[model samples]
Target: MKYIKIKRVMDFIFSLILLIVISPIMLCAAVAIKCGGQGPVLFKQERPGKDGVIFTIYKFRTMRLETEKDGHPLSDMERMTRVGMMLRKLSIDELPQLLNILRGNMSFIGPRPLLIQYLERYTPEQMRRHDVTPGISGWAQINGRNGIDWETRFEYDLWYVKNISFLTDLKIFLGTLAVILGTRGVNQSKSQTMEEFGVATKSLKG
Candidate 1:
């Protein structure tokens, strides 16, 4: 239990340091997102954090503002700009989450914060994924990211929740670097995000 306290301190200190160290890159990313399209530089969305609490998650905007081309809605891939794609490829879009970490809304390592809508879909067991603070990169992320199915991802998340430790976190941190550098498991679809969690997948009562 003391490690939880240690992890929070480390999350705060490291997030602060990393933000300062990466400010230049963050600035360029912001500018590029701004000039790349007509939308806001930063994308903000509500996500469920620990205990299913809602919090605003931040990322560099990686999709165009327009939802439709000519009455028909554009697909996510079609709406993605070249610069946005580059940022997503390099994981630059996630850098803004350091602010979330600093604010105690997230961790550097843990189960990832998922969509607000997913709150109701999770079974009682699956909802345990939020027993700890969400992270920028997590066990499910390093293992398969968006490439894996929701059930498997939730399993890995719960595994991490049960086994969180310095060594486990270290492994995830190093593995995250490899995943980013190797561009592994980055997408489950051409949309570059996971498909929505379906109600049909809820096998257990909430």
Candidate 2:
């Protein structure tokens, strides 16, 4: 209990410091997005937080709002602009999420919050991931991130949830830095991001 409180405090303080430190980069990213195309500078989406609570997560817009001939949206890679791709590759697109951390919707280290629509799709074991506040980066992120399968990702999330500690968070933070520097695990195979989970299956045992 005390550790959780301390973690939250650290998360808040570090996030505030980071926001201030990266404000310039964020501004540059916003300008770059505007120059790239016409769309909102920030991409807001609802994601599930601790205990299945919903919250608005913020990220820099890294894809152009493009449509198909029939007016449907194009695929992520297709809609991704040159500047957007650079932002994603450098992880500049995620800088805005520090605001989410400041707002208490996220933490510096925990499981990455997933789409809200995926709430109902989680198996009982997978549901355990929501036991703690979501994070900017976590064990799964450092281990394989989008490079791993969904089941493996959830397994790592659950593991972190069950064994959260200051040391664990520190490791994840350092690992995230390495990943950003190395530019690995930014996207999944053959896709800019991992594909969405359609429906929960009985065979999905987390």
CA shift of 198, model 2, Å: 3.6
List where candidate 2 sits over 4 angstroms from the true fold: 70-73, 199-202
Q: 86-180 in candidate 1: lDDT tens per residue?
A: 88778999999999999999999999998887787778888999999999999999999888988899999999999999999999999999999
Give the local distance difference test score of model 2: 0.85
Clashes of each: 0, 0
Candidate with the greatest TM-score versus the true structure: 1
Cand. 1 Cα-lDDT: 0.89
lDDT of 2 by residue, 1-206 (tens): 78999988887898899888888989989998998889999999999899898899999998877656487657777777899889988889888888888888899888999887777778888999999999988999999877887888888999998999888888888999999888888887554477676443334633
Scored by CA lDDT, what does every candidate get? 0.89, 0.85
Model 2 weakest 10-residue run by lDDT: 197-206
